[model samples]
Target: MSHAHPELRTPPALPEGGLRVIPLGGLGEIGRNMTVFEHAGKLLIVDCGVLFPEEHQPGVDVILPDFTSIRDRLDDVVAIVLTHGHEDHIGGVPYLLRERRDIPLVGSRLTLAFIDAKLKEHRIKPVAREVKEGDELSLGPFDCEFLAVNHSIPDALAVAIRTAAGLVLHTGDFKMDQFPLDKRITDLRGFARLGEEGVDLFLTDSTNAEVPGFTTSEGELTPAIDTVFRTAPKRVIVSSFASHVHRIQQVLDAAHLHGRKVAFVGRSMVRNMGIARDLGYLNVPKGLVVDMKVLEKLPADKIAVICTGSQGEPMAALSRMANRDHVIRIEEGDTVLLASSLIPGNENAIYRIINELTRWGANVVHKGNAKVHVSGHASAGELVYCYNIVKPRNVMPVHGEWRHLRSNGDLAVRTGVDPSRVILAEDGVVVDLVGGRAKITGKVPAGNVYVDGQTVGGATEGTLKDRRTLAEEGVITVVAIVDADTGQLAETPDFLARGFVSEEATFDAVVPLIEKALARAAEEGVGSAIQLEQLIARAVGSWANRTYRRSPMIIPVVIDA
Candidate 1:
C-alpha cells in the first residue's frame, strides 16, 4: 500500500528476518487498540478491540479495525493477548474468533472472565489462558511477561514481549496511580527492571498526553462520593462506565457507609458487577446489595443506585431515566451523580441529559461541579516519569488522537530520546525492528469496519451519505400503475413524501407536476415501464429542487398490469 504521508518512507516486505510491529488500530484514535508483532514467520496479536462510533457515523453501533492483513495468515498467529476487559480492548475478539477459534487468548483471570462472558453472547467458546503479573510464557519466537498496571478497570496489564529483534514494551492504557484502590500501582519497579534489561522499543498509552500534570488517583474520589451520599436529600443515583470497577467500588463503599442499600441498573452494570463480585474483584457487604425490584420498598434516603451511561448514550439507563422513559423514574429531591469523565465529542449529549435530570427535580453532580471522576490515562508529567524509568531506545505513542500522539512524541524527545528515535506512526503504518532500530517499513489495509445493528461492514460510505441525505432533505416516492400493452398510467400517480415536507399540502401541489411529466413521457412514445419511470423521476426531482431548493431521494415504483 502507498504511504498516506510521503515523508513516511515505505520499506520492503516484512524484512524476512526482522520483527515487524504493525498497529491495525488505536493509532491517531482513542479506541480499537490492536497491534501485530511478527517475528520470523510467527505473529503475536496484542489487544483486538473496537471503537465506538461518533455522531457522524449515523446508524453505526461500533467501529472495528480492518483485520484484512491477518485474516489470511491466521495459521501463523500464536495467540491474542488482551491488556484489559474494556470494550475497546476486547470487543473485537468475537469477530476474530469467528475467523479462527483455535487461537489461544492470554490475559489476567478477570480479563479472561470478561472476554469469556462476551464470547458466550456470540455462542463461541474460545481457548482462553489466564496469566498473572510476573508470569512468563513462551510462544513461537517471543517471550511474554505480564506486568500489573493501574487503569480504570481492575486487572489491567502492561505487556513486555521479548523477541529475537529486541524487547518491546507496550503499556496498555495506564496511569501511575500510586494509591490505586486495588493497591496495584502501575509496576514502576518492573518497568525499571525491564529498562535495566534494555527495552528496544516502548509503546505507551497517549490518551492524556495533552494534559500537563499527573492524573489524580482513584482514591481521591472516595471522599467526594462520601460527601454526596452524606448530604443527599433522597435516593442517590450514580452513573459511570460499566468497566470502571474502581469507581463502582467507591459508590458501593459510600452506600454501605451511609446505611443505604444499593441496586445495580443497566444491563452492563448488572452483568459486570455480578462478574466482579463472583470473581472477588468487588466487595459487597451482606444484604447491602439489593435487587432493583426492592427499591420501591426502601425509603428514598436509604437507597443508592449505580447505573451505566456516564457518556450520555441515548439508549443507556441514565439517558432513559433522564428522559423519564425508564422504569426507575427520577423523583423530586433525588441526586444523580455522573462519576465518569466526560469523553470528548460527548459533551453536548451528556449536558443535555444533565439538564433533563435537573429539570426533573433532581440535583445533578459531575466532574465539572465536583471531583467525582478522574482520568485513567497518564498525563504529560506521568509520561515523562515513565520515559525516565523505562529509558527505551525508541518510543511509539499509541491509544490517542493525532495531537495526543504528537504531544507524546514531544514528551519522549524531552526525556532525552533522540527525535529520530521517536516513531510517530498512524494506523496501518508498519514499524519494523531490526538490529535494535525501529523504522516505518510499510503500510497495510487498516481502516474502519462499521457495525450497524447485526451487520458488520454493511454501512458503506455511500450508505452513510444516503442516510444523511434522507435526514437533511427527506425522500419522495411515486407509485404508478400502468397497462401492460400501452405502458401508460392507468390512474393518477400516487405521491408520498416524508421528512421533506408536509404530505397534505406540499405533496398535493407536487403531484400535478409529476402527472404532467408522465403525460409528456407517454406523448414522447416512451414505450417501456423503465423509461417512463425514469422520465417521471427526473421531472419530479427537477421540480422539487426548483420549488423547495432541496433535492430529496425520488423513487419511481412502476407497476405494469
Candidate 2:
C-alpha cells in the first residue's frame, strides 16, 4: 500500500483529465471531516464538519478543517455534497459558507433541513439542492449520484462521482443495519450496480473497521429500552446525540408503551426533535410528548426526558445535571440512560459523569452496562462484504484513526484488492487519480482551525499550549521595578502566583536571582524594559523548573521608575 510519509513534498499541478483528492480533515481522527476534489479546474467538496474540543483544547468551542489549501480557489468550487447531518459531517458547513456563501449544498431532505436550521443560527441563507437515493446531478465536469445508506440518523447517503479521470465512490458514515428502525438497510444492491459500472476509487468509512462482526441492529434495542422503562422506579432520562432521530424514536416508543410522557430537554434536543417531528422524520404519538413544564408537574414515574450530552461535554445538559447545575437534578431512584457510543478520548469525562450521577443515588445505565447503543459505522464483516461488492480499482479509508484506517485497508486486501492499490493517506496528504491509478502525489496545509467563542481561527496551538500550562502548572507573575539611572532593583521584585506555589514567601529565593539577573543585564547594556522583562522571565522560569520541577506560564513586568 502507498502510505503518506512526513517527507512528502507539495503536490504538483493536476495533469490533464486527472482528478486530485485532498483531505483537509477526518483522516487519522474521527471528526472534522472535509475533503476537496478537483477535476477540470473545478472543485467539489464533501462533508465540511467540525471536531469537538477535547480536555487539552481548553476554551475552544469547535475545531474546523483548515481551509488554507482551498481558500484561494473557493470560486472554483461547485457544491458541498453532504452525505449526512451528523455534527462530524455538517457542523463546519456554516463556517465554510461564511467564506463563500454562494456554494450550493446538496444532500437528502432531512440532511438539508438539519443544516438549514444550523445555518439560520449563523444568519446564512444557503443555496441548497435536496437530493435522495437514485438522484443524479451534474455539477461542472462531475456527474454525481446519491445512494441510500442506513445510519444512526435518517436520510444518510453515499455519493458516487464520475469525471473524465475516473469514478470515485464516497461512503459517508454508514452501516448495514439489516433491521433498521426505519426499515431502511444499506443499499448493497446499488453498490453492486455501481461496482458493475466500474468504480475507480472507493473512499469507505473506517470508524468501526476493527470490530469483528456485523453491528447490532437498531430494532433489537426496543426491548432493552422497554425493559428499562418498565423496571425503573422513577423518571428515566435518556441522553443521546440530538440528531439521532432513530434512537429518540425508540425512547419515545418505550415511554409511550410504559404510560409515560416524554419531554425533550436541552435546547438542541428540543429544536432538532421539533424539526424532525415537523418534517415527519420523527414519529410522535399525540399526547405522548409533553412540554418540559407540563412534564415537571407529572409524577416522577410518569415522566421521561430526552436530552443531549451523551459524550460528557462539560457544558451540555446532562453534564450540568450531573454537576447539579441544571434545573433537572439527578435525585434518588432516578434512572439515567446514556444512549450513545463513547467517542475516544472522552472515556474519562463520561466515566466521571457516570460516577457523579451514581453518587447522586441515580442508577446510571450506559453501553458498558446495557444494550443502549450501537455503532453507526460498518464493522469488519460488513466492510469485507462491501469490498467484495464494490471491488474498486483503488481503496482509500476515510473517517477514522490510524488503527481503524489500517484495519480497513487490511480488510480490503484480504478481500483480494492488491495491497499496492490501497492508499493510506492522512489529512493534507494529496492523492491523485491518473491513468486509472490513485497515488499519493504530495501534501497540503491541513491543521486545526479553532473556534473560540464567536471567533474563528483566532485561537492557535500556542494559545492552547499556554492554556494547558495555566490549567496544569498554573501561572506566576513577577513585577520588577528598576532604577532609571542605575538599572538596579527599585523594590524587591514582587511575586504573585496562581495554580503554582501560592505563598509569597515561596519566591523569596527567586527574588535575589531576579535582582542579580537584572543587574547583570544592566552591566551588559540591556537597557530596554523589554530586555529586562525577558531576563526576569527566564530567571523565574529557570528557578521554577529547578525548584519545583514545574514550568508554569511566567509573566514578567519591568517598570523603569
Candidate 3:
C-alpha cells in the first residue's frame, strides 16, 4: 500500500495488553490538539485540531500538533473520531489525513460534510463513515459510540469508547446548551448508563472550566442581535466563526426581524453557510439571504453583512474592510456589531479592528456595552454537572490552559472524584490502565506544529520567548557582509530597527550603536562563518537597551563572499 493510503489496521480482538491513553497536544496548551488511546497495538485518535496563529506568524494558517510520534503508529490508528467542526477540534484533519490516507474518519453528518469540504479544499478525499447519536461501531479492537452533545455547532458528540480495559468518555467541545438554537442536548440517559455500566476514564472539555456556571446558549444572543438590527439607524456588520451555524442562524433571523437582507462575505463564511443551509443546519427564507456583491448593489442601510474573522485576522473580511481592502467597506453611520468574543490571545487583534471601525465613524458592539456572543462550553456549574453525571473512576482534563486544567481538576476532586483520580496530564504524558485500574504510565515528546502556508513545521517555544522579549525591548536587524576566507569585514554594517523608537530623529540612535557593534566584530577577526556571525550578533544586541528604550530583534545577517 502507498504511504499515502494510510490505513489504521484494526485487528478484531483486543489483544492481551493494558490500555494506554496519551495526550499529544491540547493538554498543557490550548490548540493543535490530539489525543491517542492505545490498547495493546490498536490505536484510536480523538479530535485532530490546530491552534490559530499568533501575532508573529504573518502567513501561517493554524498551529497543529506534531504527528511525528503517531506517524509510525499510523497503521495502529483504527479510527479518527471527531466531536465537532471547530478548527481546534478538526482543523488538523486535512493535514493528518493527507499523510495517513487509510484511516477511516468518523463523525456526524454535519461534521463529516464540513470535513469533506475542508478535505476537498486540499484536493484530498478522506474516507469518512457518517456517525450520529446512539450510533455504535466496532473498529479493529475498540468499540466506539457517538452521543450527540450541544455546542456552537451541530453534530457535536461526547464519545464513549469501550475498550478491553474500560470505557473512556471523550467529550469534545461542549457545554450544557439546554435551550440551544439547535435544540440539541447531551444524552443524559446515555451518560447515566455509562456511569452505571462503569467508566474508567473521562476526558472532558475544559475550555470554559474556569468560568462560574452553565454556558449561555446561542439562543440567548438572538434577541440582542435582533434589537441591534431592528433599532440600528444605519448599516450592520457582524462577525463570527464560519462554522457556527447556530450563531449564523441568529444573525439571519435578526436580519429578517430588522427587515434587512443578510449578506455573507469571506470565502470560508460563504462556503460554510452554504453547507449548513443545504444540510438543514440553518434555514434562510429564500429571498432574505444573498451575497455581499448583491447586497452591495442595494442600499447599505437595507443590508446586514455577516462575515468571518471575528478574531481580527488581517486578511479576514472584517480586517480587509478595516483597511479599505475588502470589496465592501463599512462607512460612517454603519454599526459594526462584534457578535463574537475575542478569544483570549486574539483580544488585541479584535480590538485593533474595532479601533479601525470606530476610526471610520462606525459604532462597535461588544460585551462592555451589550450582549453579542455567548460561549458554547459549560462553565464551572455545568462542568460540576457533568462530573455528577459521568462519575468516572478517573478524570483527565483536556482542551484548556494549564490554570484552567488545574482548576477543573480541583473541581473534579471537590465533586467527589478522588484527588488521585484527577490527573493533571501534560502533553505526551501517558496514563496506563491495568486490570481496570489506571495510573500515569510514562511521557512522550508531544508539541505544536505551525503550518506556514504549505510548509508545516513544529512551532518553537522560542517564538514565544522572542515575543516576550519584544514586548520589553523590540526588534533590530543588523545586515553585514563577511569574507569567507579571511573572515574580514566587507562593508559597514547596515542597521534596521522597528518598534523601538519614534521619528527619524530617534531612529538614528540605533545606527551609531550598530557602528560600535561592527568595530567590536572587526577587532575580534573571523575564525569561521559561525564565530564571526556570533561576534557581530552579541555586540549589537548587547547595546540595544542603553540606546533604545526596548531591545529589538537583532538580526545580524553575515553574508559570506
Best-performing candidate as measured by lDDT:
2
Runs of candidate 2 exceeding 4 Å displacement: none
Tens digit per residue, CA lDDT, model 2, 435-554: 999999999999999999999999999999999999999999988889989999998888888999667479888888888897898789888999888999999999999999999999
- In order, the Cα lDDT scores of the candidates are 0.89, 0.94, 0.79
lDDT for each residue of candidate 3 in 1-561, tens digit (9 for 90 to 100): 001011322223333767888787788677767888887688899889888877765456788877876788788888898888888888899888888787899899988898899998889878789989999999888899889888888889989988778888888888877777777887877888898888888888888888897777777777788888887888898888899888888888888876899888888999999999999989998799876677877876688888887888888999999988877767789998877776768889888888988999899888768988888787999889888988989888888888888888888888899887787877777677777766775566666677766777733567556766777566767677766665555765666766666554554454555456556655676356566666666666666656554456776777876
> Candidate 2, 33: how far from true, in Å?
0.8
Give lDDT: candidate 3, residue 106. 89
What is the number of residue pairs that collide in model 3? 10
- Candidate 1 residues lying further than 4 Å off, grouped into runs, are 1-11, 480-492, 503-539, 559-561
Residue 181, model 2: lDDT of 85
Write down the lDDT that model 1 would get: 0.89
At residue 93, give the lDDT of candidate 3. 92
TM-score of each: 0.92, 0.99, 0.87
Give candidate 3 misplaced runs (Cα > 4 Å).
Answer: 1-16, 56-59, 458-533, 545-561
Candidates 2 and 3: which is better by lDDT? 2
How much lDDT does candidate 3 score? Answer: 0.79
